[model samples]
Target chain A: DAGITQSPRYKITETGRQVTLMCHQTWSHSYMFWYRQDLGHGLRLIYYSAAADITDKGEVPDGYVVSRSKTENFPLTLESATRSQTSVYFCASSKGVPETGTRGYEQYFGPGTRLTVT
Target chain B: AQSVSQHNHHVILSEAASLELGCNYSYGGTVNLFWYVQYPGQHLQLLLKYFSGDPLVKGIKGFEAEFIKSKFSFNLRKPSVQWSDTAEYFCAVNPYGGSQGNLIFGKGTKLSVKP
Candidate 1:
C-alpha cells in the first residue's frame, strides 16, 4: 500500500495486441525503473525515468515504450506484444539524495506483472 | 557498458551451512554495488550495498559482502544459512560517471537451503 505496486499481476494477451502495465509508487520517488525478469537473464532494465516527463532507454528497450506523466505513475506500453515479450515485468522506485548522487539510493520493487504473450 | 557476473547459477546447501555467493563486475573506476534478494513469489529486496568508505558492508538478515577493488568482486556471504534463506540473489552495479539510474544486474544465483 505504501510502496510500489503494479496492476494486472497476471496477464494473458495475444500477439499484435496492445497492453499497458501500470506502475504506481506512493513514496513519490524521483526515479522509477521498469525491468523484465527472464530465466538465465535475471533482471534486465527496459526503461527508467528520472522524474515526471523524463524517461530513458535501458539495456533492452526494444518493443517497449514507457511514459511518466506523473511522479507517482510510470506505465509501460507494448504497442504490439510478441512471444519474446512474455516475461515477468517488475517496477521499482528509488528516492535519490542530492549529496550521495543519484546512484546512492536503494531500489524498492513491486510484486511484478506476469505477462504471457500467446 | 558495465556488467555483473554471478558465478553460481544454482547452489544447494543444508541448514546451518555456511554460504558464499560470488559476484564480479566489469567496470573500471568507482562503482556502487548492491546485492538483492528475491524470495519465492515476492519482489526483490535489498540485502546489502557498497558505495564508498568501508569495503566490508553488512546488510539485513545476517548477510555481509566484501567489495574487493583489486579483484573487481563483491561476494555475498552468510556464516550460517537457514531454510528461509532459500531464494534468488542478484548482484547489481552502477558505475560512476554515468547515469545513476542505469544498473547492470547479474544473472542471479538461486540458493536452495534444505531444512
Candidate 2:
C-alpha cells in the first residue's frame, strides 16, 4: 500500500526480553506517533517524533524507547518487556501541526501490531 | 494533562435505529476534536473533525458530530444506522498550540447493530 505500515502483525515475547516494533510511512509525513491500545484505555500515546531527529515522551513512556533516525521510519523498542506491556500497538503519521493560519491535518494510522508478553 | 471520556462503553441497536455516542474532554484551552472508527480487523480511520467555525461537522459514511464548547463535548450522531456501522468509535482531542501533533483518545465505544 501507499500509506503507513507496521511490521510483525502479531508477536509473542517472553518477559525481560527486548522487542522492537517498526513503523514506516511513504507519505514523508513530518510527525510520527506510537500508541498502545488496551481494554479500558482506548489508545494512549507512548511517544511521538516531530521530525527525523526530534522525539519526545508521551503520556506513558516508561520502559519504552523510540527513535526516528529517518523521516520514513520510526521504531519503538520495549526494553525488558513485562506482561503488562502486552497490547495492540498502533503507529500514526501526520503532516505536522497546522500553523497559525492553516487548517488542521488528519492522522493516518497503520494496521497495528498485536504484541503479547508471556 | 488532558483526557477524553466516552460516555458509553458498549451500545446495541437494531438496524435503522438512531445512534449517539457522547464524548467529552478535560482540556481547558483551544482544542481540535475528532471522531475515528475502526471496523473489524481494520485500522482506525477518521470519521469527522472540528477545529473551528461551524460546530456541526459532517464526516464520511453518513456520520456527523456536534461540538459544544461550553459543555466540552463532541457527540456523534446518525439518524438511522446500518448494520455496517457496527464498529468501535473513538473520540480524540488535540490541544491547539501544542508543540507536536499528539492526540488524547477516549476509551472507545463499541457499537453492535443487529441486522
Candidate 3:
C-alpha cells in the first residue's frame, strides 16, 4: 500500500490506437521513469520526469509521451500503438540524493504492466 | 555511451550449489553498480549497490557482489542457492559523473535452481 503501483496490469490494444499506462507512487520521489522491457533489449528507458510538469526523453522515446501532472503520478502515453511497441512496461521512482559528486538515484519499481498490440 | 553486458543469458544449477553471475560495464568515468532480483511474480528489488567506499557489497538473501575496476566488472555471488532463488537477475550501472540517473541494465541472467 505504500509503494509504486501501475494500473491495467494487462492491456490489449489494436494497432494505430492510443493507449496510456498509469503509474502512481506513494513515495513523493523526485524522479519518475518509464521503461519498456523486451526480450533481448532488457529495460530501456522511454521517458523520465524530474518533477511535476518537467519531463525528458530517454533512450527509446520515439512513440512514447510522458507527463507528470503531480508528484505522485507519471503517465506514459503511446501516441500510436504498433506491434513493435508491445512490451512489459515498468514504472519506477527514485528520490534524488547527492552523496558524492554524483547524484544517487536509487529506484523503486512497480509491479509492471504487460501490454499486447495486434 | 554507457552499456552493460551480461554474458550469461540462462543458468541452471542444483540446490546447495554456489552461483556466480557475470556483469561488465563500459565507462571511463566513476560508476555505481547494482544488482536487482526479480522473483517470480514480484517486482524488481535491490539486491545490493556499490558506491565509492566499499567494493565488496553484501545484500539480502545471502547475496553479494564485488566490483573490479581494472576489468570493469561487478560479479554477483552466493555461497549456495535455493530453489526459491530461481529468478531473473539484472546488473545495472549509473555513471556517477553523468547527470542521467537512468541505469544501463544488462540483458539479465535467469538463474534456475533445481530442487
Q: What is the TM-score of each candidate against the true structure?
A: 0.95, 0.96, 0.96
Candidate 3 chain A weakest ten by summed lDDT: A96-105
Q: What is the TM-score of chain B alone in each candidate?
A: 0.97, 0.97, 0.97
lDDT of 3 by residue, B1-115 (tens): 7899999999999999999999999998788888999888777899999887878999999999999999999999999999999999999988865555788899999999999
Writing each residue's lDDT as its tens digit, candidate 1 over A23-104 gives 9999999999999999999999999999999999988899999999999999999999999999999999888622335446
Q: Which segments of candidate 3 are over 4 A away from where they belong?
A: A97-103
| lDDT of each candidate versus the true structure | 0.91, 0.93, 0.90
- DockQ scores of the candidates: 0.55, 0.70, 0.55
Using DockQ as the measure, which candidate wins?
A: 2
Q: In model 3, what lDDT does residue B26 have?
A: 98
Residue A45 displacement (Å), model 1: 1.0
**Order by DockQ, highest first:** 2, 1, 3
- For all candidates, the clash counts are 0, 0, 0
**Native contacts present in each candidate (fraction):** 0.51, 0.60, 0.36
Between 1 and 3, whose lDDT is larger? Answer: 1
